[model samples]
Every structure is written in C-alpha cells, then in structure tokens.
Target: MSGEFGEEEQIEEQEGPAPSLAQIKHIILILSGKGGVGKSSVTTQAALTLCNMGYKVGVLDIDLTGPSLPRMFGLENRSIYQAAEGWLPVPVETNGVGSLSVISLGFLLGDRGNSVVWRGPKKTAMIKQFIKDVAWGQLDYLLIDTPPGTSDEHISIAEQLRFSEPDGAIVVTTPQSVATADVKKELNFCKKVALHILGVVENMSGFICPHCEECTNIFSSGGGLKLAEEFNVPYLGNVPIDPKFVELIENQTTADESLVESYGKSTLCPIFKDIMDKVLAQNRPARC
Candidate 1:
C-alpha cells in the first residue's frame, strides 16, 4: 500500500488557512511501524539530550490517544494557558537542562487514560492547530512524537510541514524479527513520503545483567545496525533492557545522571550524546 494519500488536493483546499512554519531549525519525527517499541522513550531521551547540550527544544506529543511524554518528563499535571489567539505550551525543566515545551491531547483532555474517540479528520485538524496555533518560539529542535503505524495523523504532519527538504525521522524498533518486520514497513512509509531517514535505534537489544556486569543477547544483537547498513542509513545505537529503567518509567522519573548510573551502566548519557552529534551534523546546512 502507498503511504501518500491521494486526497492531498482536497486537504490543501479545505485545511482553512495554512499555518506559517517559522523559527524552527529542525523538525524530527520519532516514529515506529508498530506499537510497543519504546519510540516515546527514544524521543524523550533525544529531547532531553538536546536540552542538556544547551539547545532550545520542544516536544510535540502527537500521539493523541496515548500521550506519554508528559508523564515521562513529570508534567502530567501541567496545564496550557489560553491566550487570545492560541494556546501556550507548558514548559518543564529537566535537571537545569533548559526548558521543554510540550503539547499533547492528554493535556487538553485533562485525563491521561481518557479515550479520544475522534475520527481521522478530527485528529488531522487537531494536529494542524497544534503545529500552527501553538507558539513554539525559536526552537533549535522540535521533536514530534507520533502514534505508531502509517495513519492520517502521520500523513497530515508529513504533508503540512514545510522543511525545505524532507525532515529527518528516527525509526525505533526492537531486535525481535516481528518488530524488525514492522520497522521495514515504517522505513518504506518514510521513503514513500520523502522523509529523510535519520537512523534506526534498536531498543531492548540486550539485557544487561547488573549482578554479573555482563551483557546477554535477550532479543539478539546488531539487528538494527544490520538493517541500517542494508538500507544505507545510519545506525543510531542500542539501549539495553534494564529493570531499573522500566521502574523509572513506571514511576515517571527523569533520566538524569543518577538514573543513568543506576541502571544504564554509564551508557545512556554517551549513547544520547552520540545520537545528538549525528542529528546535529545531519541537520547542518550543506556547505556551498
């Protein structure tokens, strides 16, 4: 099946007025072909890493039905203020690493577990307003955490955002073949939509034994790297399955140095740094 919708003309005509895209340096879409691949975790880490590096960052949680960024960053109770023109994003600080402006349907719904029983068009409308109406002032990076699978929300954002070229996307997956198969579909979706593939991040690639300080290939190692090589894209890195990490997420704790050292074996910070380096290098304007 094709990724691009044939109804672009109708959408363009009926979208009311197109929103102005400005002051956004890079738009990074964190996506996956299937659910439960830790896509949101990867997105949260990327945003936090950028903030730690002294860059202004904003995260747009486009996962309307299941928003996790707010909870992950400890901003679930936060509220957005309403100005005359549009809504103002609530900024949350992470370990003195600048501020993170966030917008999610969960914020609007006021209940994390509330179901959003809207259709595709309604979802598309909300996304358009989130991108256009919200005031994301002078952001170095805007990480958009999208819902899994190629759906209307995904297509709407891909078509609407004017990035000069294709905005880069990071595909998240696990080492399991089922997850890899879905990632292939996601890859094809990105390629079909003309979005640049930043890289593929393999989450839960292995289990790091805290007792023995040895790594075990719980799911199998190097699947993401091999897939990236096969597709001629970059291999971002891997994040081990740590029980403590799971606990942190369950308890809505930020991934600061303490948490990283506790569970990540001093690897989370470095892995995030490397990913940021690659993202910045890729986003830099080509030398004339």
Candidate 2:
C-alpha cells in the first residue's frame, strides 16, 4: 500500500462525507520538507491575511509533536471542549470583520511541557480524528500547519484529506541551499501523492533591520524561486526575517491588542497581504 492505503482504498475513503471539512470552502496546507523553515509561521501569516480580507479562517495545527499555534496566537491558556457534535475549537480574537478559530493538540495537553511520544499507529489515529472530529463550522479558508518532511504524520494527513478537495499546499523553504535540497524532496512527495501545489514561499529570505527598516539578504536569496522554476511551480514570494515580527509573537502575552490586531499593525502585514492576494486570485473560481 502507498503509505497508509492502497489506491482503491483511498478512493473508497474519499467517497464518504467529510463531516469536519464539509463547510470549509477552501483548505490549504502549509508544508516543508525540512524543519525550522518556519512552516507554521507561514500558516499563521496566511490565516491572519485571509482574516484581514474579511474571510473567516480556521487553522488546524497537526504538528503534533511540537504544537505551537496556541503560544503563537496568544491562546496558550485556552482549552478545547467536547461538544455534542465534536470538539469545539478555541476562537481567536481579531479586529477584522471575519473570524478566526484554531484546533491543535497543544490545547488539549494538560501541561505545555508535555511531549507527544506516540507510535505510528497512535499518531495516525490522532491525525484522522483531528480531521474528522473537530467542529470547524463554516470557514472561508482552513489552513493546516503540518510538521516537516514526508513521515507517517504527513502520510496520514494526505490520506484523510484526499476527498476534502484541499486547495493544495504552500511549500515553505529558506534561501539556503541546505534547506532547498530537503524541500525538493517535499515537492517530489507532493507529486507522488497527486497533491496540487499552489506555490512556493521562501521564508527567512532576508533580515529586516528593526532600526532602519532595511532588508538585507543575510542568508543569501533566490533558492526558493530557483526551486519553483526547477519544479515548474509558481513562486508566491519571499518573506524576510523581521525581528519586529518575532517580537510580536513573543510579546503577545503582554500586548493589550489581540494577535490579529497586533499583526495588522505590523509591517509584514502588507507583504503577506500581497502574497495572499496572488493566492486568492489564482484560486478564484473560473467564471463563464
């Protein structure tokens, strides 16, 4: 069987209704072949950008081993509750017209320091349950923040989401050659699984000086664009390492504003807005 199931089994699975994902208009996965490439960061920015555009959004953090969405969105103290239908995701406060909600293993853990040490079967079960049991309600966009590489977790996610008609993946990578090499494998994995690639996003492409607000290519640049060209995929754009953005995540605890509100004031807001604009335009329904 290919990863979790044979081709015929995959078809049979997709024929059933996806309860949790039914009302989600568009589903996008933020992926990476290597860790520490800021895949979750990309997911966060994309969700915030979509919310700012007045589109209701949901973020599913399946990076089970290292669920950080709770801390990033300043909802670390939040917890998930069991509703009659399914698990209720915690809603995030945003100043925009749209709403944002999230579900992650991080919120379910009794302690933040606990590690998820599970075998393949257990992890696979959790991934499937996350896909089927979360009550996401209606969402204009559902962005899944995935762990790095093509492991069992990734395979389980692909198998479960096969029928949901995910919009596709946004591959995140760094400009460095080492990162690009591993990210190339992720591109191949997507092709093997027949997952349509929406585009490639090069994160940490440069460093934005906090003082002068000038961007310097400290890590070099163009590796992501090169990969996109080599693989014949669209290069969405590059995101610089903005210290202010880091401060934003770190300062979320003390800040009086909601994470969304705080992010709306960030300089990176315009950058991601432009990038997500490309995504929106590309995903726009073709009209007669």
Candidate 3:
C-alpha cells in the first residue's frame, strides 16, 4: 500500500525534528486504515481529555484534502497568525485546568467549501510546512490527526518525525471485519516504519441510545480487539456512537464554554479517559 507513494520521503530534505516539536514532550498520531472510522473524533476527544487533565496540548490536522479539525473543535471561522517563531495556532478555550491549541489547513483556507486539489509533490510540500512551520510553544502532547491510509502525507510525517521520538500511534477502526482488514495494512505500515503502536481504539463499536443511554451492538463488536490481539498491541477500548457527542461537536455553545468543557459533561468522556489512561500508561506521564 505504501509503495504507491514512491520516494515520498524525498519531497523535502531530511532534517531533525521540527522547530515546534522540540518543546513538545510527547507526540501521538491518530491514524486509520480506512476513512470514516472517526479518527478525527478520537484525536479531538483525546486532546480534550488531556487538556481537562491539566496538560497543555496541540492538535495538527494533516488531512490535506479533507481537513476537518477546525470544525470539530468549533473554530471553523478562526485563522492562523504569523509570529516571530512561526505560524501561531488558533487556541481553543478550554475553560478548565488545561489548554488546547490547533493547527490545520482548514484554518488557512479562507472558504470552508474550498477544495485542496494538489499533486503528490504539492501535498508533500504543504505537509512539510505544517510540520516545520507551526509554532506550538511548550506542549505536553501534540496529537496529529492524519488522513486514512499510508500515503504522501503519512510518508512526509514519518520522515519529519524520525528524530522526534514520537510517543506512538493510536489506530482507530470500527468493530466491522472489513474495517479491521483494511487496518491490518496500517499496522504493517507502523511495523515497517518502526513506529510504536500505543493501542487500538474501536470507535463506533455500538450505538448509545440518547433516550435510554443503553449501548446496542449495531455494528457487531470485537473486530478491533481481534486486530489488536493479532497485532500484539493493547486494545484500548470500544467507543459507542453517542448522539450527544455529535451534538457537542456540531452545536454552537456560549463563549465561556469550549468543546473541552462541553465534553466533560458528555457520557463518553469517561470512556475516552480510560483509553487515554491506557495510552499515557505506556508513554511519558501526563500532568493532571
């Protein structure tokens, strides 16, 4: 699968860790073997969980063709700014014990409807700029939300972070056999690149009824766990589809309340906390 993007590492010169990454203690990539498995949602909840735990966090959305973190974090209208260090990421109002900041091509595009139509070389260049140019300042964690599959952007990120010693990757997938099959390629990609697999998250394993709050196995559960076991990685946990969580992402809240704040009240918050706990247990300790 990765062979399709031949010599993608040569898109930019090999260098040390990006300037912004130097001050970051840990970096975790949110990845998937296929799309629409809620990878971005995992990244968002992870960041919010860490922030609520009192850790400073940054999120970089590298899904060039379909950047959606800005909308997920409810900062769609926000724009990036240039400072002496580099591009200043838009800050999320945590309104809690921690802080959250974000950088994404979504912020750079003036129009939400704009499409990023570019060749492999162009996409690689933009990804390089995103990795090297953003000024994240000091952060406890930087969660990179990547496009599904192993492609140009993935190659570029792997090349750039070669020296950064990233914490690892949290692979997201549904509890469907097909999703797990595609995700096997992703696990293989991690092994080939020597990137550590922190764990596997089974997102949308079931549907949580908004009325009764009972979880129903709409998609049939256990595929994600089977994949993790087959790959010899930790199975973080299963995440049920919650309507309130979707509302939290889509509904506009008051200025004093941020996504993180709103998430604290959601039923899924504890589920993600357990997943993050399993992740942090393997990496550097996060502040709480």
Candidate 4:
C-alpha cells in the first residue's frame, strides 16, 4: 500500500479547500538541485532587496531539519507566538529593509543544537500545517527557501501553493557544468509539475579580489546562462563572490550588529537588485 496510493495519503486525498494565502500576494519558492550552492543566501538577499524596494516581504524557510535562516537573519533566539489562527512569525529587520515576518523550524525548537528527527510523512504533514498555521500578515511577496533537490519539501510547497499558482521558482546554481546538470533535472521537474519558473541565478560566478578589486572567473563561467538558454528559461543574472557577503555570513553568527548593518549595502546589493528586477518583471504579467 505504501508503493504509490497508500492509506497514509488520506489527508491529501480528502477534499478540502486549500488554506487561503490571501494575505501574501506573491510566493516565490527558491530551489537548487544540490546543497551548498548558496540557495538560501540568494533567497535571503532577494527577500531583503525586494523589501528594500518598499515591498512587504516574508521568508518561509522550509529547509525543515537544517534551517539556517534564523542565524542568517539574526533571529536565532527569536520565539514564536500564538495567533488567532496558529503560530505567528517574528519580524526581523536590518538597515531599514526587512521581512514583514519570517517562520522557520528553528524558532519552534528548544535549542539550536536540538535535532528535528522527522520522517517523510511527518515532515510533509508539518509543512502542510505550517502553511495553514503561520500568520504572515499582508505581504507583497513571500520567498520560500526549500531544501536542495526536487523532493518532499519542494513537493509540499508546490502542493500548498497550488491555488496561488505561484509567481514562479528561482533556481540557483553555480557556473559548474556538474551543478547545471543537476539543475536541469530540477527545472524539468518544475515543468512537469506545472510550476512556472522565474529564471535561474548564477551565484559565485566570479570572485572579486578584496584588495585589488578585480573580478576573476574562479569557477569557470557562463554555465548558468548557458543552461537557461538550453532550457529556454530566462537567465536572471549572476552574483560575484564578494568579501562583503562573506562578512555578512561571519557577523551573522558572532552577533556583530553594527558591521552587519553596514554590510547591508554590501557590493551584492546592486547585483541582487538587477536579478530582482528580472524577477519582478516576470512576476508582473502573471496573477491567479
């Protein structure tokens, strides 16, 4: 019975209206075929940039067991609250640009080191419940950072946001052919599931020397744009490796608020803005 249509899928099989995400206008799920490709970074940067543009943005970290957003946005000690519906998210702000709210599995845990030992059924069910429970007030955009690969987490988000039809997913990748190969399958999976793709972003495409301030292709180049052309999806843009972004990561863990705020206008800001422009451009003509 567990082969395909099993008894455990009764929750999904039952006829029920999807939760109303009416408060959030656009939901963009960010994915990568493999981990360590900086998908979460891109997701956070995009959310911050969009919020900077005067849009109310919320980030839903669906990474589940390995949630990094709490530390990434400096909300490690944040707590969740009770809402009329369910648990409410804690708003995190930085340099006047921030999310309306953010919800991560980290906030619900007792300690940062505590493990979330959830299996498939339980994890997917939690995803469903979180979608129904989180009280993300009126938001212009909600960026969902998914665990790498086209698996349960990705499927859960797609199913939950089916009614909204999502603005689209932004795939992140490196300039390596190996990464692009995996991303190709991820792109096809999205196509098969009928999720529109905003486009693909090449991260760490080039490295900028902190001293010389010169850009160099450290991971080869053009693979992301090439893959987009091959798949006929838009090539959003690329982000070069910057020391400022590195500082952002380091300060996130050490609680260096002053340095973190100053780095908000890091070199990555301009690059992220260019990519978000393409995302908004594509997001505009579509609405469900």
Off by over 4 Å in 2: 1-14, 211-215, 284-288
lDDT of each: 0.75, 0.87, 0.87, 0.79
Q: Write the per-residue lDDT of candidate 1 for residues 230-276, one digit (tens) a residue.
A: 88888888888867655665554444543323323435767778877
Q: Cα deviation of 47 in candidate 1 (Å)?
A: 0.7
The sequence of per-residue lDDT tens digits that candidate 3 reaches over residues 1-288 is: 348766434334466666667888889999898999999999999999999899999999999999989989889879999999899999988766788999999998878998989877898888879888889889999999999888788888888888778889999999989889889999998987889899999998888676897878887899999999999999999998877777888884543577787788788899999999998888554321
Query: lDDT of model 2 at residue 50?
Result: 88
User: Which ranges in model 4 have alpha carbons more than 4 Å from their true place?
Assistant: 1-17, 94-99, 252-264, 283-288
Clashes of 1: 0
The lowest-lDDT stretch of 10 consecutive residues in candidate 2 is 6-15
For candidate 3, which ten residues in a row score worst on lDDT? 7-16
List candidate 3 segments past 4 Å from native. 1-13, 211-214, 254-256, 285-288
lDDT of 3 at 152: 84
Q: Per-prediction RMSD in angstroms? A: 4.0, 3.3, 2.8, 3.6
Query: Over the stretch 1-288, how does candidate 2's per-residue lDDT look in tens digits?
Result: 265664422322455557778888888899999999999889999998888888999999998999988887888978999999899999988865699999999998988988889877898889889999999888889899999878888888888887677888999999999999999999998987788899999999998676797878877899999999999998999998877877999998888988788888898999999889888878644111
Clashes of each: 0, 0, 0, 0
